[model samples]
Target: MNENKKTLGELLNASYSAFGYAIGFSCLVNLLMLTAPIYMLQVFDRVLPSQSSDTLVYLTIIAILAIIVYGILDIARAQVLTRVSWWIDNKLSPIALAKSLDHTLLGGSYAAQSLADITTLRQFLSSPSIYAFFDAPWIIIFLIVIFLLSFPLGIIATLGAIVLLSLAILNEKVSRKPLEQANTLHMNNQESISNSIRQAECIQAMGMMSPIVSKWLHNNEAVLAMQCTASDRSGIVLSFSKSIRLILQILILGVGAYYVINGELTSGAMLAASIIMGRALAPAEQAIGAWKQAINALQAYRRLQHYLSQPETRPPEILLPKPQGRIDVNNLLYIPAGAKKPVIQGVQFTLMPGESLGIIGPSGSGKSTLARLLVGIWPPTNGTVRLDGANIYTWNRQDIGNHVGYLPQDTLLFKGSVKENIARMDKIEDAKIISAAQFVGVHDMILHLSHGYDTDTSRYHLSGGQAQRIALARAFYGSPALVVLDEPESNLDQEGLAALELIYKNAQKSGITIIVVSQRPMLMKHCNKVLVMRDGHMERFGLYAEIIR
Candidate 1:
């Protein structure tokens, strides 16, 4: 029940033509449903009184035809609604994902919330929450029709419905606070459970099973107590409202019966009036349910809106074409949040085209940050990263991606064949694929696989070092102008490290600019120069011997 910053009207406005058509179809279905009861009353009051057998037969045939038509319309309406929901889900998912990625790259604190909010929003979109829009409008229309048919009776019924709705709203207001508390407790309990599972091995090793289990149970009990209390409050209110509505219905029926007996109204008219009252009241009850669902949907929408509002780390821009890769950081400055001083303050460096530079530093130094800045993962607080005298940020994201290749310490491989993982399903010839794998020292491993390059990596996996090599192969697959590797030899043994050194030599030989961040002295030996960093600032830049000394 949080106040929605973006209203339902705004959402509808943002929706495409298909959404409008779906709503129109749903309304037509409701119109057909309303007609069925009216048609029934016509047959009972007018057609039957004529006492013509043929007329009765024709009326019955028409009613049956209307029923069939209504059924078909209902089916089509459901189909359209389903499709609309799917379309919204599909369109919104990518936008949500992109926003989350942008926030993460920007070092936004709410990145995790962005992911959770997107998931909840998608669920709301696909659930009964959206259908409530169709139902609520139809219910209002039904109530209006009933009011027109019988003034006094409709007024009485309307009063009863208003009372019921008011009570429901009051109940919602009273229960929402407790429901929120219960939900908070539930989330805390879930987090505790997840942490317990993730640290099961450590817990067992420390023999703290009893303490962990006791804590988990305590949290679970607290969550359960909160949930039960909330549920009881909601149930009591709903039961009371339902009872009042039932009493109102009985009173209306009794009044109608008395009027019929006193000859103030005909028997058929009384029956029709009772039927209309029920139809109108039924929609009111449905509307209450829809209102509850709307609250949840609105909450989900608000969460998504918060995610979408986060600032982008690297705004999308178009970069001018460069003939060669010449990286220059002019008075680079990076100040992480809550830090007193900027990392890499007033740092400046320039690398000519095809120059291979190595960055070496202790842990927690600015080596990785500098590498990230060079790759455009983070923008400097002050200063600029330029390629061929033009700011890299000015380039289109896709263009930067095509020109620069980055390999992080933790390489993630998707579930696919080696060929698909390496080639990325591009139309690369086998010879090129083999050459790239060979250049990265993974060619022999691929040859040994059951299907060679076609082997399903998802079924049979590679070790960490092998995976890193494959990742390296993929990064260098397109022969990007600038290749940045962070801790390339961290997981590799001596043999693998030797293989990587050869790969680096070959890359430099091919006139591709290479920048590597590593702690290993052996890797730095092959570089022409080494850049040393400490505490987010560059300390030295010189030959490997000079820096080591």
Candidate 2:
């Protein structure tokens, strides 16, 4: 990933057919554009000498038609390029999103960074500027045309181009270190600012506003200093390059004047040569800048690729048959990354169909981790988690997802209508959505809104409890075989908690296996059995009364 071993041509070969076609069309348009100067020169030098009114009129019409043709080609090329960009973006977005989602399921520090890098790569790759490779080759074509027209003039143009391009490339290299640093610092500053604003009330309550502001200001100052230095250096380099290019241009014209005096070149030819030289050199300037940005984009891409290539906890091809609403963990020893001790050493548990199990533990116990493993969010390090006697890791990811519903501590609600949030998919029936919401005690809340289920609650109108209930409704909407709830009772009031208990009871009667990780004793009271964990190890597994005793 650290090596830059491939050219843009090789990299783009991985793109789809539509992308290739679009790039090809863009190149064609650029080649066509290069011919316009040659045509103009021919008209000025040859057609004007005849000086016939009809001939001049005809030539003018031809030139106008050519301009119109060029305009059409340019428009077509732009349209094709846009389509390619959209196609590639759409294709890559899902892969990047899926990788991020998968990383979330397998939590770790590297996983977190991998998700962020995927997002950045998606954004950078989707930009239209990344596909500038198609237009770069036209610079060579322009130079060749200039050489064919006048060799000495072409040499001067090439020399100026090299100088300007070298300066641009060097400028890019010098700025990269600072630019990368500035970007990272800016992200840190933004995070600090966001944290400060989000916890402004807490800061004021604790009289810690000064400290929070100071930290945020420190991050901001670092970012600003890096940006200022990079910008100043870039400006100086650009100014110098422009000055040198202008001098080279003047020298070329002075040499061309000598050729004209020797009757070796026409004024129109010299003018055309200059125009072509500018056209030839412009893309070189663009390429220098593009190459710099591309390098940065590629670095981000390598990070993203590493994430996409990470091994999942379970492979997709492996198949675990649908369970009979039973789960078992036999002598399971769960060790998280960088932990010296297993979280759930020698933990043995089993649940029959229609039975409800409650997991209870203090903070730092492995209650949540156990629930995650049961639901196949992660694989055990030293033992097997079984579903109906089939090892859970043998189950396909989609199959496990379909049968096991997991609700984490934090409930995420998307910005949409209440119905959209509840259904989660367009194909979900309205009646099913209503029933799920009603069962979870959020139907009444929805009905009270202006549009009932159709009401948009994206403006932070819903309370934490309301959002949690909605999330629960979504989880239960499909009637999964097993449901794992982590801290589901945290934000609920007494009535809401009672409603949740009733929902679980109903689910149990329907033969669904319910596993809850909760700190509340009241919630545990309803369970048939309770598993108590301490210091990442299960201390007891028995009925609630037995465990309490």
Off by over 4 Å in 2: 1-23, 34-36, 108-133, 187-210, 288-292, 318-322, 424-426
Error of 1 at 240 (Å): 3.1
lDDT of each: 0.70, 0.73
lDDT tens readout by residue for model 2, 365-471: 98888887887777788788888877776577666666777788777787888888777654658888988787677788778777888777686488788778888
Candidate achieving the largest lDDT: 2
Residue-wise C-alpha lDDT for candidate 1, range 66-88, written one tens digit per residue: 77887887666666656666655
User: Which sections of candidate 1 miss by over 4 Å?
Assistant: 1-19, 47-50, 109-132, 137-152, 178-230, 290-292, 309-311, 424-432
TM-score for candidate 1, please give it: 0.86
**Candidate 2, position 289, lDDT:** 49
In candidate 2, the residue pairs with backbone N, CA or C atoms under 3 Å apart (3 or more residues apart, or in different chains) clash, namely 343-536
Report the C-alpha displacement of residue 443, candidate 1, in angstroms.
Answer: 1.1
